[model samples]
Target: MFINVSDESITVNNKWERAELAQIEEISMYPVALIGDVLQRLGMMASVIRHVAGKATFFGTVLPILTWEGDNLAIHRALDDAQPGDVLVINGNGEINRALFGDLLGEVCLARKVAAVVIDGAVRDIQELDAMGLPTYARAVNPAGPSKYGPGQVGFPVACGHIVCNPGDAIFGDRDGIIVIDRRLVSSLAAKLKLQDDVENNFRARVRASLG
Candidate 1:
């Protein structure tokens, strides 16, 4: 597996093993509007990456940045090296002119057991991808194809909305929005998230009784 020198220590561990992951996934199944309120209190932004028109939740490590107007070399490389719970985050500037992904790449990712892909760009071959049950989040859908030029970077920090993502940062996305959580902060954040849930549940019960 190819790895950048700086990310040598970044072992690809299954973050789902952490109790926090299950907790987060459980919370995510709730109404997104409610989740947004919780995220706001937690000081996290929900980065939206809409597909052409479908529903799916994507969770994985952020392999940040696939340079605009260039090939997906870094993405391919990252896919080769990525473990099961890794997402390929391509910052395409929301360009709908060209497709950043297709069935071929998706197949490789599926074979490798990649978690999902989040693109602030275009993706093609929607039906095939959907049928395969591959979780892909992108800004738009266009038949336009991307250039396969050489040169790109991986395992580095990149931007998605107002957040910066390192290669191994845990990424969570559903119909609501994409949330990037720093792996180091998971333990602490988990505690706070539970508190938020408790308050919300209490509020729900009160509202229910009022309605009755």
Candidate 2:
């Protein structure tokens, strides 16, 4: 699912219509657990990836980074190009032999005010990443570093964590797991998620009363 190409400037477009802040905040208020339920058990990323740092909850429009396995130069470009409200949903093709990101990159992302990072591959420096206090999720961690050698793409449609990621799709994550929502679906889904949460809450309250 990955290929190595000579180093060159990636031509993938940088700008895409992102979800609104109001939508993002509303969605973030709901637990991923509830959102997962409302989504009809959809948009879940591969379960192999787990939270390894910072606040367990993170939500933002996806900024996908597609790279050859074990390579990270494109990630640098992504960091440089990322805006404050982006979540870097990276596709390293599930390569685990080399760690594609680590503490150094984590610091840059935090400084840039990025919302979070989700790597569908290996990362390193778990302690430092946690210390930096930014959300990060990855498939695995290794001490081995990545090759900065190029041949990767950024801001493109990519598949990661067993699901397809479109640039600007909304990404939501927490201690429970990660969920992706199509940008166009945000308004509708947010309303549905709230309704579902209310329904579940009422049901749970009723159960408690019956037991009493």
Q: Rate the local accuracy (lDDT) of all candidates.
A: 0.64, 0.86
Candidate 1's C-alpha runs over 4 A off are 1-48, 53-55
Stretches of candidate 2 exceeding 4 Å from the true structure: 1-9
TM-score of each: 0.78, 0.93
lDDT of 2 by residue, 1-212 (tens): 02344447554667688888578878899988888888888889878989977778889988899988898988887776788889999999899899998988888888889899899899999899888888999999898999877678888888888989999899999888999998998988878987888899899999999999
lDDT of 1 by residue, 1-212 (tens): 33232333222322333224454455445444444465573423335566443347766566676555534555665675666666787777667788878887888888888778877778899988887788888777888777654355666666755567766666776666667766665445555556777898899999999999
Instruction: Go through the candidates in order and give the clash count of each.
Output: 0, 0
Pairing residues by index, what is the TM-score of model 1? 0.78
Residue-level error in angstroms, candidate 2, position 122:
0.4
Most TM-score-accurate candidate = 2
Candidate number achieving the greatest lDDT relative to the actual structure:
2
